[model samples]
Every structure is written in structure tokens, then in C-alpha cells.
Target: MTQRLPFLDRLAVPAIAAPMLRVSGIELVSAACRAGVVGAFPTANAESLEAFAGWMARLNDEAAAAREAGTAHAPWCPNLIMRRDPARVRAEVELIVRHRAELVITSVGSPAAVIPALHDGGCLVLADVASVHHAERAIEAGADGLVLLTAGAGGHTGWANPFAFVRAVRAFFDGPLVLAGGLPDGVALRAATVLGCDLGSMGTRFIATEQSLASAPYKKMLAASSLDDVMTTRAFTGLPANFLRPSVVNAGLDPGGTRRDGVGAGGAPALRRRFRGRRDPALGRPVERRALGRRGGRAGHGRAGGARAARGIPRVCIGLGFSLKGASETPDGLRGPRPEARRGVSLAPDFLQ
Candidate 1:
């Protein structure tokens, strides 16, 4: 990649499977690595600290096996939410350092508290940001890189255009950059590179992959969905993010794109106490999204336990212009109005190759 980061050299495709909540797990993460891209999952996805340890052990084992077999694969990174209970966060820090994680992506909060320890353990820290200010803060906090969670990203997204956002950050920071949004194909990945990102961070695209932890019905619904079928609202977490419109409708919530249940000040506690009483036909239960990269059962976004909708998305926002033009299967997926779709994408050039 343009950044000369050694790990980038090992990836066949300059991309990372986002560490989504509930959506990312061992299967999805492992598959992404096998596909020549970084695979990641949120540590908070596990119900408990012990369960988190087991998940990490299994992932490390698989990665080690791949290495021993001389198979080409990328690294498995874990996303950590730093604003949780202090003791719990500290425990997670110990586990991460003990595992000797190669890359740790910190989200929703500052990386400052955990950076020194992670660095001490030889783990490079990449902070997730939705704004230029956050990017600056992350850099000042000694993050090794940045993941720009731009607009159109599902599960709490920023509104800045990817092109503008990357340019804004590149003005001061020249370290590694991973752009995350509505990227769904190689062309979008290439487009991200052209905009100065070293890697494209894709979450929605991996949801439908064969190894995704998403339910079959959810995957099928996503594959059948288009840009319009996706809805953007601040009601879920008080941060604008995209969600499947039909899913919202299925929850008996208004699909008119207005804020009805956003977490107001001190709203998290009350929301967190609410339970997921509604069962979804597509998702089986209420969906648990990466709300502000929150930990534990959260609100409105539908965790089975408590309705703890997180409120820490320091904002940003892509879903458009794509053509799955092998002409093999019906071309129905995330598409924008860009004219580049007709020609199709080729292998990435010098920077990515």
C-alpha cells in the first residue's frame, strides 16, 4: 500500500472486514483472512470476559495454523470499546496484551488509555474516527493509524463524504488510513485507495459472505436490497446510521426516516433497562448493531437483554454506484449513480499490489 506498512504487503486485497457486533465472529473473521484481507470482530460480542478469552484463543489457533501451513492470509484484528466499566476494560486490556495481538482497533472512545500498554505488547493501535477532530485526537493519543468511519456505514455512521473526509485527514496525518463506508466491491476498494486510504474497511459487504455470522434470512434480505431499501436515521443511537428499512418496518417502528427513539441525555440507562421483546422474522431476535462501539447489552438497536442503545458516535457517512456486472446473477445490491460501474474494476495498481 502507499503507506509502506509491512502488514499491508501480506494482504492480497487491501481491505479489512470490520469488527461488527454480532455480525463478526470466528467464521467471518477467519474467512476474511482467507480471502486475503484483515478479519476482525468486536471483543464485546462475547457475553463475558471468559467467553471473550475462548474466542481469542480459537482465532489465534486458526491464524497460527494458517501460518504453519504456509497458507497466504491476513491478520485477525479485534475491535475494543474503551468506555466500558474500568475494571472490565482493564481486564480486556490484559487479555489483548497477553494474546500479543498484532493489531488492535479502538472505537467509540479515545485510544490514549490503552495505547501505551498495547504498544508495549507490540500491538499497533488504530483508532476509529468519524470526524477530523477525532482523527487529530487519536493521532495526538499516539495511535499508529486511523479508520475513517464515513457516511453510509451501517450501525452508526458519519455524514462526511468519503472523498472530503480522507482529504481533510490527509492534510495533517500521513500514517496508514482505512476508509469504511458503503464499500462493497473491488472497485470501491480501489476508489478508497485513490482517495489516499491505505485500505478499505468494509462491514456491509461481508455480511453476505458465505462465512458471515449473519443469519441466512438476513443475508438474503441484504442481497435483495438496494440503496433505497436502506434507511438512515438518528433514532437508533442519536447518531445517523443506515439500516435495512424493511427490518425497521418489521420491528413495527416508523420507516419514515425520522428520529423517534434516539438516546437523549441520560437516556442510555433507561434504554439499557428495556428488553428486546420483539422477535424479528429475518434476524430471529432484535438485531444488535455496533452502537457507538458499545459494550454489553444495549438499547433501541435491539440487543436481546437490555435495550441499551449507545450514544457515543462522534459522527460522520457511502452506499451507491456499483454494478455486479458479471451478468451472471441478477445485479441487485448497493449501487450509487456513478458512471464507472459499467466498465467494472480490475486488480488494484501499484499502491495496493
Candidate 2:
């Protein structure tokens, strides 16, 4: 049996807006929460601690106002990539505790050291893991939940099949399990629940949403592309992750070629610098420090305009292409009806029957 959190049990939609490094922002998070799903963004999206604090303040204020207005939004989540510089990780953990964010997501490393602090502050921690080994470690580290990032998940995803992954993890731990990868529609979400996952995590689908900070070109590329367009490579981040092949081509790098200087688990340290400091030739400008700190005016790594300009590198890490079909009009060539055709299938416990 799945061990449910009171908060998760109350969600109208058993889904979460997976945190994408360059796509998630306050606008997207707030929108998803308002629409009855858990909305999340990454702490690393902020260029500095001050900016992170400001973004959190804004998010909290907006969420509070929404709740007072009788909106049934789920708690907002901030993903902390645990494998970055130790000092940076500590600082982020401090900020998360200071804000008392109700839900926190940890990825790319063990949560043992950080989980205690979050738990102490009455925050629920969900660790992202690609395999059962990591799943067991996260559970031992006292994470309240696990985000099983199986094959096809965007950004440093695991290679396990969701079926085997969930079943394997369920054998030992039943605590709120979320299945992440290729969850394109209500049917996929429903299937995850039937497979014993507490919620289905969707990233790419949300990228095409109006609220997302993804650039117009990025969104257009997603809509036009298919699974065949997604290539898994460790070149950019030094860890295997899915990226759009076209983005690589646009960046003047061969998607099929090997440029493997950095390759290892937890590529956070090296990738962090590149993601923040490298300007993409495609965006045509350097990242201004002021823009990164701006509160109401696009303040994260993933959003449109300033954010994209700031980290002006070719966009990689777009997740599985299958999920984008619903939001896209372009056919993927190999097809059935687009995901949008199927509707009204609810994963909510009350609506399940």
C-alpha cells in the first residue's frame, strides 16, 4: 500500500509539475498549483542567494493570496540539486529551511545531510532517484517520498522502465512514490497510479504551456519534434540526460559526435558553472547580473526573455518528446491520435471510480 501524505491525499489532481532547470519559474509553478497540481522549480535557477530569497518571498505571497481566495492549490516545491559545491548546497538548504517551504525536492546526490534540516523545519522532502539503489538510499536518508525518474524523464534521467522501477521500489518502500517520464496525458497518469505510483510527474508537457518560461523557439521546437528527436547524451552536463537534437545542431555541435571531457554521476559542480556562466550564441547577449536579480521581471534560469538571454546556451534537457504531442499541432510522423484527443480521465482518487 502507498503511504500517503495528508497533503498529497488532498490534491484534486494526482500530478506534479516537474522542475526543469530552464523552464520552471514562479509563473509556471503558481499556475500549476492553481490548476490543482503540485508546482515546483529549482533553487539553482536563481543566480544568487538574494535572488532566491526574493523569488521565494514572491511565491509565498502569491500562494497565500490564492489560498485566501479559496483556491485549492497544492504546496509549492523547490528542487535543491544536492551535488553542487558543498558550500552552495549548505546555503541552499539553509534558505529552504528559512522559508519553511512545505515541500522540497533533492536531486543528483544523497539527501541524508539535507533531509534532517528540512524535516526539522516541518518540510517534506522528495528525493529524485533513477534506480532502486538510490531509492533505498533516499528512503534511508529519511526522504518522505521518492520521485522515480525512469527512462525518458527530462534532465539526467534514469534508464529503468517505469513498470519494473515502480514494482522494484514498491517491494520495500511504499511511501509516496511519483513516477516521472513520458507521462503525456490523463491515461498515462492513470496508468502510473494503477502501477502503484502516488502521482505522475510531467515536465515536457508543462514546457509547452503558456505559463512556462521556455522561449518561443524552444516551445516551437518541442511542438514540432518527436521521440526520435530526443537524444540521450552526457556531453552538456557530464551525466546522461535527454536533449533535443535540433538544439545541439543549432549550437553547432554534432549530436552524434563525442565531446566527453566531463562524464560522471552528479555533474552538478561542473555543469553549474557552464549553465550559469556560458552564454549561448543563439540568444545573442550576455547574462546581466541585474536581470538575474529582478523580481517581477523574469528571475530564473528557465523562463523566457531575460532568463534565456542570461543562460544563452543551446537549450538541452527537454525530456521525452512523446509528452509534447498534446500541446503540439505538428504530427510526430509515426502516430496514433495526438494526446489531446483523450480527455476526462482523472487520476484523482475521488474521480477514479
Candidate 3:
């Protein structure tokens, strides 16, 4: 049987904007909640604990104001990378508990040790899992839900087909299940529900949004990129991750032949420099407008969550090209027409509204 959590039942859109490193922040998270979806950001994204506290305050304040206005805003979630570093994990856990965060997403390690504290504080914990083994372990460790990171998800991802993964997990546990990876539109969101997932989690699609913390060129690059432009490599973080080839090259490394000798030796610094430029801007800024077109959809493009429709589900198009100079394709074997720029398909209006 399917399970329902209080927060999941309150969703206006059965989706959660995945907490992304560097890309997610107050603006993106707040905008998502305002648009009626759960908004989240990683604790690692904060420059320090002080900064994280400030972000938490802002989110709490926004949520209060929304409540006062009688607006149904989805809850704000903060992601904690449960690492072996005991000190770091302890500090982050303390913050989550102190703030009484409603929902939390944990990654990189087990939540077994931390789940009880969070639960006692009325926080729901969702563990990120790439395989069935991890899913079972997470549940055994007391996670309230499971977020299956399937293939094509941005950042560190898994190769499991979402359908098979969800089926396998449901066989054992039926609590709230969230599916992540390549869910760029409402149709994909509907598909997740049909597959028995409580929520569809997405990250890359939001990188193109103006509220994101990514640079202008980075946002443009994501718009111009496709599955072909994505390269899975372990050179950056000692774990497998998907990165845009153009961004790799822009950092002065060979995308085709990049290598790292040790954890702190090579590629890591360059990759960091590429995203976090010499001078980064503050967190608060006005949201910009960027267009993303859907495959086989009409010619109506607007800001994130602002697309229009005629007789069916509104087509929210995100421009699939991000090359500043508009490079048609990458030189690597990964090549294809931009996936987000096509048109002609439609979804039932009922599923969308």
C-alpha cells in the first residue's frame, strides 16, 4: 500500500526541487515553495554555519509570511551530507534540530545514527539511495522515506532504471518514495506518481532557472547542453558525478582526458574555480527569465513555472542550449539534437492542474 506523510499531502505540485550543490540557495528554494513545490538546499552549499543559520532564518521568515497571507507554501527542506567526518555531521545535525526543520534529505553516508534525533524533533528524514541495498539499509536505519537517484540525475547519480528501482523498493518498504533524475517537466512529474512515487525530485532543470546561484555563463551552458554534453567522471570528488564537458574545458582541463591523482591533487581545484569564480555575488537577487522548450510541445515559453497551455497541460519549455557562443555539439562521442527544444507532445490537463 502507498503511504502518505503530512508534508507530502500538502504539496500543490507533487514534486520537490532537489537540493543541489552550488546551484540551490535561498532564492531558488523560496521561489520553488512560492510556486507550490517543496524547496531544498544542501548544507554544504553554505559557506559556513553562520551563513546556514542566516539562510534558515530567511526560509522560516518566508514560510511564516506565507502562512499569514493564507498561501499554501510547501515546506522548506535542508540537505545534510552525512559524512564520516563526525565533527561536521554533529554540527550540521545540531543546526537542523535546533531550527526544527520540517524535512531533511541526507546523502553520502548512513542516517542510522542521526534519524532518531531528527525524528524526536519532528523532522522527517529522506535518505538518498542509488541501489536497493542502500534503500533497505536506509529504512533499517530509520529514514522516513527514500529518494531513489536514478540514471541521468545531475551530480552524483545512479544507473538503475527508475521503474525497476521503485518496484524493488516498494516490495519491501511502502513509505513516501521520491524519484530523481531527468524529471524536467510536469509530464515527468505525472509519470512519477503513476510509477507509485510520492514525489518527483529534480535538480538540473532548475539550474537554468534565474533564481539559481549559478553564474550567467553556467546557466547558459545548461540551456545549451543535453544528455550528450553530460560526462560521468570520478576526477572531481573521488565519487562518480555528471558534469558538463564545456564547463570542464572552460576550466583549462581536457574533458576527454582529465585525471586526478589523489583526493586533493588534481581536477578538484580547477572544477571548484570554474564554478566559484574569483568574486561570487550575495544570495539575494531578482529572478531572471530563461526559456526551456519541451520536446514535441507548442511555442509558449515563459519563466520557470510560468508556461501557458491551450487545451491540455501547459508546456513549460526550458531552452536546451547553453553554449555562450552556441556551439552546436560537443566534440566527444556524446552528441544529439538538444532534448529540451522540440515541440508536438501533450499531456492531460487534469494531471497538470
Estimate the lDDT of model 3.
Answer: 0.64
User: Taking the tens digit of each residue's C-alpha lDDT, what string does model 1 give over 1-353?
Assistant: 24555688779999998887667877888788877789888887677888878877877887788889998778888888765566877889899888877898988678899988899999998998888878888999999999997766766555567889999999888899999877766887899998898999887766666776766656655666555555443333333445665555544433442333223233333332342343333334443322211222122321100011125311111332111110011122111111222222211111000
Model 1: weakest 10-residue lDDT segment is 344-353
lDDT accuracy of residue 51 in candidate 1? 83
Worst 10 residues of 2 by lDDT: 298-307
| CA displacement after TM-score superposition, residue 56 of candidate 2 (Å) | 2.0
User: Which stretches of model 3 miss by more than 4 angstroms?
Assistant: 257-353
Candidate 2 stretches greater than 4 Å from native: 256-280, 283-318, 321-353
lDDT of each residue in 1-353, candidate 3, tens digit only: 67786876557889898987667888999899888899989887777888898888888888889889987888889987765467877788788888879999987678887888899889999999888888888888899999987766676555577889999998889899999876778898899989889999977768767798878877765665544456553333323345666665664434433332111223333333333322212212211111111221221111111122325432332222222111212222012112222231222111101
Tens digits of per-residue lDDT, candidate 2, 1-353, equal 56786677447789999987767877888788777798888876666899888877877787788779976768778988765577877888788778878988887668887888888889999998877777887888799999988767764456678899999999999788999877766877899999998898888777766778778877766666555566554333223445565664564333332322111232322322333443445644442222111111111111101012114332322354322211111122111111221221211111100
TM-score of 2: 0.73
Score residue 223 of candidate 1 by CA lDDT. 62
Which scores greater on lDDT, model 1 or model 3? 3
Distance from true location, Cα of 58 in model 2, Å:
2.2
